[model samples]
Target chain A: SAVISQKPSRDICQRGTSLTIQCQVDSQVTMMFWYRQQPGQSLTLIATANQGSEATYESGFVIDKFPISRPNLTFSTLTVSNMSPEDSSIYLCSVVFGTGGYEQYFGPGTRLTVT
Target chain B: AQSVAQPEDQVNVAEGNPLTVKCTYSVSGNPYLFWYVQYPNRGLQFLLKYITGDNLVKGSYGFEAEFNKSQTSFHLKKPSALVSDSALYFCAHSNDYKLSFGAGTTVTVRA
Candidate 1:
């Protein structure tokens, strides 16, 4: 199992501003992923961060709105750019490990409230 | 694309009683299924997974899950429920690198 941590566990920001959430893993991992969960809703995959390249985002999500940076294998940051009230949600980071393994260890998540 | 379904919005079980959280999935080709638990203000904790193994898999906190390929189901079970067991549970399915999650089910264990 992997121990992941996020910064700014909860924050309140004004609309039109940007908030960058950080994710750090206790150990190196094969892959890292970002997710968003709306209040009372299911979790949605935002993007997959690569070690030395651009992140791969899911459908209906673009890098312009959720820019991701992964400078190394153990750390990554996801920035919610040009935030709106609709962007208020809990963002979680997950790391993939174990060859041919399906389990993903997730971080506690950063709760963002866009006002 | 793969999808998961958690049939119940909430499940209620008496403490010391057996509990089961139902989960079903739909995917093309092979399926990688997993269960997760989330406490208040906490992250989703890995419970158990059924990739390619025996029908039943055991996990932390005295929890177990059974993988039934014919039903496309992987249900979480516990012989005894604790008050601490009251939390939200999510079912997820993986096809490739991405893992899809269900809406999640809130479980309340009564003491």
Candidate 2:
């Protein structure tokens, strides 16, 4: 299993501002997934970041709103642009191991509160 | 596509009592079922998984889940509940590379 570390465990941000969350994996991986958990909602896939390529965003998500960057195999960044109160949620990054996809490890998550 | 469902929003259990958290999944091919626990302000910790072989699988923290092919269910269970066991439980399914998580069930254990 890969150990994932996310920065800014919790943050209070002003509306219209922006915040970036960093996810670092202890080992190299080909794919890193980002998810959002809104209040009283299930975890929703935001995007899949593949190193050396643009992220593949899911439906209802756009590049401008939630930009993702995978600079290397072990690290990725997700930025919430033009924050609003609706943007408040826990952002988690996960990495799957091996071809079988038997296990997936998640980061503690970045708790963002937009006010 | 793969998806999971947790029918109960919350479950309350008395200390030392047996507990069960229900889960069901849908996938195109063979299903990989998993149970994860999440404490407040923490990431999801993998408890157990059911990929192949035996229906009954044991996981961390004395948790276990039984996979039923006919019913398409993987229910998590604990022989004895403790106050420390209170947390959010999520069921997931994987067929492709990504795993789909359920809405989550909050378990509150009363002493």
Candidate 3:
């Protein structure tokens, strides 16, 4: 299993402000992903953070709203831009590791509350 | 297109009783099903997965899941429930390295 950690475990920010969440893995991983979980809802994939390149975002999410940066295999960041009340959610960092990379491990999410 | 469904929103069980969380999947090819648990204010923890071979796969925390291809179901099970087993459970499927998660089921095991 891969050990993952995230910065700013919980944060409260004013609306229209931006916050960047950092994700670090103990070891190199093949794939890194960011997810969002609304209050009392299931997880939704936000984007795939690719090392040394731009992140691949899922539909309903765009780079302008959530910019991602993956400088290397062990580190990545997701920035929530122009946040609003609806942006208040738990953002999670997940990675795929191990032999076939079938299992994905998640970091203790960053809980953001946009006021 | 590949996805998993957790029909029940919540499940209640007593300590030492059998606990089951139902999950059914729909995919174009062979399914790669997985179960994960999330405690209060914590990240998700992988419990078990069914890739191939064994229909019954055992995982951490004494949890197991049976994959029934005929029913397109991979339901998580535990012979005896523990109070600590109370958490939110998710069923997911992987397609092209991307995961599609179910709506999640909240399990409450009361002592």
**DockQ metric for all predictions:** 0.86, 0.68, 0.85
RMSD of each: 1.0, 1.5, 1.0
Ranking by TM-score: 3, 1, 2
Mind giving the per-residue lDDT tens digits that candidate 2 earns over B37-99?
998878888899999989999999999999999999999999999999999999988656667
* Clashing pairs counted in every model: 0, 0, 0
* True-vs-predicted CA distance for residue A59, candidate 3, Å: 0.9
Best by lDDT: 3
Tens digits of per-residue lDDT for model 3, B41-96: 88999999988998999999999999998999999999999999999999999876
By TM-score, is 2 or 3 better? 3
lDDT of 1 by residue, A1-115 (tens): 5578999899999999999999999899998999999999889999999889999999999999999999998999999999999999999999987567768999999999999
Clashing pairs in 3: none
Which 10 residues in a row give candidate 3 chain B its minimum summed lDDT? Answer: B92-101
Q: Is candidate 2 or candidate 3 better by DockQ?
A: 3
Q: Name the top TM-score candidate.
A: 3
In candidate 1, which residue pairs clash? Answer: none
- What are the Cα lDDT values of the candidates? 0.92, 0.90, 0.94
Rank the candidate models, highest lDDT first. Answer: 3, 1, 2
- Sorted by DockQ, highest first, which candidate order results? 1, 3, 2
- How well does model 1 score by local distance difference test? 0.92
